[model samples]
Target: MTKLSLKSKVDFIFIIIIGIFAILVYSTRNQSQLARDSRMIVHHTSSINTVLEKILSSTIDLETGSRGYTITGNENYLEVYNQGHKNLEIWLDSLRAMNELNRGQVLKLDTLERLIESKKQISALTIKTRKESGMDAAAAITKAGRGKEIMDSIRKSVAAYQNQSVKLLSANLNQSEVHVKSRNWNFTLFAICTFAILFFAYLQIRKNTERLILEKIIQTNLMTELTVQNQQLNDFANITIHDLRSPAGNITSLVATMEQDSTLEEYKVIFSMLRKVAQNLNESLNQLIEVLHLKKNKIIQQELLVFQDCYSRTIESLQGEILKSNALIKADFSQINSIMYSKIYLESIFQNLISNALKYRDPNRRPEITIHTEITKQTILLHVSDNGLGIDMSKNGSKLFGMKQIFHNHPEAKGIGLFIVKTQIENMKGRISVQS
Candidate 1:
């Protein structure tokens, strides 16, 4: 469950839903086709019945018109005969067309068509006999009963066709009833299955949400505890640095006083060394205090500071060292001369890097430290390159920014400068790197 991501789970649920919906669509389409077929059957049956009745009615009209003309020799009876003949042809054609699908009905319709034709021929013969011979002659043809036989046959055929159509209609209605029931059942089953899947998905989502909320609460509590512990550690570190500063100052003062009182030439060298050690200790302590102060204020106010101003201050502070080492320092801030940063951090960074370069200068050549700024699409870059007794990266790269990690054998190699610089940069959400 933990291995499955939220997107994967959601996709799986949707796949199931889509599969079910596709099945429902296919099933409903088949049911709809069944319903459509039932309706077509019902319509065909009704049309066949109507055409059979009309054929019977038209035959009756022909028989009545021929009989009337045989008795009275009326021309109106001939008109009825002509109209009935036209109606019979039309009704027969319609039946033939409609019954094409049913072979049995086609056979019945063929027999009915022959019977109607025969009935029309007899009526035509009687009418011709009445007009050409006389009423007596027409009566003689009708008296033989051939026309009545054909009429009875046609009636029987029509009744049989209508009965078959009624049966077909009944069967289709029953089948349609079954299809409707099946469709209802399918819909109910589909509804139940869809609900089940949706309910299961809902439960899974609720469970995942609850678990996430619990994890978030646990994480928040841990963070709160960590913040409190970090604050306490900072307080302890500040107190320790404050206490240590006074002793380091006393040592510096004592060394300075002892140096002034020295009388012998040999003692002068000892005093000078002693004074250097005390001064170095005081500086280290001061640097440590500065680092502690940086920790105390995690978020410091930033102001726009000119790169040239910070560089000048760092150079002025290290004037003595620069002159002693015969260092060549140059800077180019043409691309970006100013930045938004903590003044203390920027000045300390310059002071540390420049001083280290001077301190670790190659004795064979004059120290050359080049500082420049560059602007890229995303960020402003500051480069500080130096020609010094370079570090062996493979040996001391990992420990370069570690406190008290000395790589050089110089007397002033406290190893805290790089560490402090790294800390300051990181606090400002910036990073520093070195290459040799």
Candidate 2:
């Protein structure tokens, strides 16, 4: 498992907190919406009940007024009967307006309205019969009216509707209660989770503070050790340049004077070989001096130069040697540019590799030096290859870059060129290797 950093853990907790907050908001909104729907259901049911009561009251008024008119022949009673009929129609119209409640409720409503209409028609017929004819005709009309059956039906329908409305109201109340309970539980969970998140965040902050202090102490100790090592390295470089390089310079001067003496003719080949050996030794010593000086990982006035431009400078410095050897120098830096590198060291590196190619050129073939660079996963690599007298890996591979170890019998085969290249590469924390 990958371990999470402090920041990652904090972010994860923050995300969790946001998610919980969102869920709580959604839950609360859902609960509120449910409450609204429940209220609407109750209100609709109550409105239906009120309309039914009005219809019942109006029917009672019509019954009393019609009976009073038949017995006492009162004009005021007829007016009451007319007004009750009008009120009945109004109440039924109100019920019809809310007819979209439920399919069963609408069907029940139709039956109740039909019963009320039947009662109104009978009452109107009975009153007309008593006014036109006599008590006997009105009695006959009453028998046909069937008022009791119609009233019973109206009552039964009203009761059924009331019962259904009550059931619906009860169901809505239960649903609202459940929503409220769920919302409360969710809010409780949110509060508990929020508290836990804060507690863990506090602990994580404290742990991070302690870790930062420890890291600072470690960094300070490391800095002190690095300072001591740097001083020791500087002392070592001065000793190598002063104490070791002076003897090599003196040896080179002695060999040059000995080479000029005319009396050494009988042993001229020996002297020449001795001079070559001393020069190689002196050159190798000078390379050691340079390596010591450059061993420190310090770039003095470092510059960012184009790789192609650096190669051009090196080629210009060795123009005579390149032409005399009939050498072809090729370079490619097309894919990348402005690579930050030490200009002086880059020029030196390029010069040594190119000059060695010319000096060690094969007798039968002209020298073709190819210098290129490419980026790898870990670092940028600089490659210098030549189609000249290449080193015989099977013979001189072990000493290819060793001090004073020569690969070819060429005059400049002091083995210091690649050593200098390797040292400069090391100072920059880079690796150098050869495939052949």
lDDT of candidate 2 over 1-436, digit per residue (tens): 9999988988998899899899988988988898778767756765666566567657766865776576556778788788889888898888888876568777887788788888888888889988899767886665554875786677678768867876876677667666655665766676667766766776876634454345446645655665565444433333332222222333333333432123424234333333343333333344444443454444344668899876765554454465456788889876565566765557667767777778788889878888888887846778889887777788887877665567777754555667666666665677788866
Alpha carbon deviation, residue 211, candidate 2 (Å): 25
- All candidates: TM-score: 0.44, 0.44
Candidate 2 stretches with Cα past 4 Å from truth are: 1-8, 140-145, 206-436
Question: Least accurate stretch of 10 residues (summed lDDT) in model 2?
Answer: 238-247
Candidate 2 positional error at 434, Å: 99
Question: What tens-digit string does per-residue lDDT give for candidate 1 at 252-285?
Answer: 3333343222444433343334334333333444
Q: Could you tell me which residue pairs clash in candidate 2?
A: none
Which pairs, if any, clash in model 1?
none
User: Highest lDDT, which number?
Assistant: 1
RMSD of each: 50.8, 49.2
